[model samples]
Target: MTAGRSRARGVATAALLGALLSTTAGCGSSPSAESAETDGPKSTWEEPASYSYTLTSSTQVLAGTFRVAVRDGKVTEAVGADEDSRRQAHDLPGEVPTIGTLLQTLDRARSEGADTAEAGYAADGRPVRISLDWDKNSIDDEALYTISSFEPTPG
Candidate 1:
């Protein structure tokens, strides 16, 4: 009976160790864009050639990355997760948001003019935490958007 109990305990220990090892193993050299969250120092804002993003607003959010065709500083096309969204996005014209539009918003905040601009970045200098408002201040904040899970797509 003692031996049986010992074997069970040993099995439990091995299971725990295996789970720990597997979790650590996933954090190897190549981290996916979703994995590259910035809980660290922020450097200059460097926009990748192309990327995927999750846009969150006060009311709604793009469920996943929306690919787009950029032409002359605008989103010419908005690619969605499915065919229905694709058609809707494409039909909306400039109403849809894309990687280009997000970057353009950041750039405009500096060069064009913004009411308020506060941002945080990742180790790789991607903007992870952003709070920009076209109107109002921290007290009565409105029109502020936060972007996250930004992963650079290979050009």
Candidate 2:
């Protein structure tokens, strides 16, 4: 074969191979493709739920709030404005804190205290609710407590 013709044939073969590989890969996952296209846009937190509450500690009086979105039963977002309060709570003598520690604390308080909070599902099975009059006075009053929560909304 002519050198020029051979080179053209090689190039064409490579292009065809690439196309075939891509198509094969795409065809292997129909459900994933449908979900990717049908689910619209993805959120950092899946099935986000929002909450607002208060945190009263020995050193500070903070209004805590947050938005938590879970996907596959795993927490995806946990943010709040009361960094001081959160830090203090984590620093408490027996507290083991983390990004999702606030929620655990709140849940514990709810279970042990007399707070009338409610939670429910929203769009796409996303849980949403609010807990008012919640208390976290375990920390000192002088500690810096801002509007803190797990997965807080931007001001």
Candidate 3:
């Protein structure tokens, strides 16, 4: 192609890209923008007096079972299955996502289009599953987390 024609095509392409970006730049809300008042009583997860659930990867690999009671925002009586999980449930303090952080991530996924790679939630506002990719639109099966068999720990 002629230099003039090539330059014209490049300019057109750049203009189109610019227009698309400008429109989308302001399209989404940040997680911090989520209203505290609008969230009401359900805004934060109530510390489950007791809780139990199985954690799994996107590929359905069992990470472990987390069985514990919260006696002041801390896990107690922690128990975990051994055959399948990588670590004991008691080791979850740093290994896995907490209820508060996971919920914030899920909320961001709902409001911020580009922030989350994939996400799902329970009907009662809990993180049933979640994944994060930030700027990339790719899936990481390893990052995929599914919380199943959620139940309040029985006395």
Candidate 1 structure lDDT: 0.48
Top-lDDT structure, candidate number = 1
- Superposition error at 43 for model 2 (Å): 19
lDDT per residue for candidate 3 within 1-155, as digits (tens), equals 47785555445534543454365455655322211112212234454655655565322122445543344344444555564343544444544444554556556655665443444446555565555444443322124455667777554
Model 3 lDDT, full chain set: 0.47
Model 1, stretches more than 4 Å misplaced?
A: 1-43, 58-91, 98-100, 110-114, 137-141
lDDT of 2 by residue, 43-70 (tens): 2233233333233322223223333343
Could you tell me how far off, in angstroms, the CA of residue 63 lies in candidate 2 after the best superposition?
4.2
Cα deviation of 114 in candidate 1 (Å)?
A: 4.2
Q: What lDDT is reached at residue 17 by model 1?
A: 36
The best-first sequence of candidates by lDDT reads 1, 3, 2
Supply the TM-score for candidate 3. 0.45
Show the lowest summed lDDT stretch of 10 residues, model 3.
Answer: 32-41
- lDDT per residue, candidate 1, 30-57, as tens digits? 6454334332233356556566565543
Worst lDDT run of 10 residues, candidate 2, spans 138-147
Give candidate 1's error at residue 154 in angstroms.
3.1
TM-scores for all candidates: the values are 0.43, 0.23, 0.45
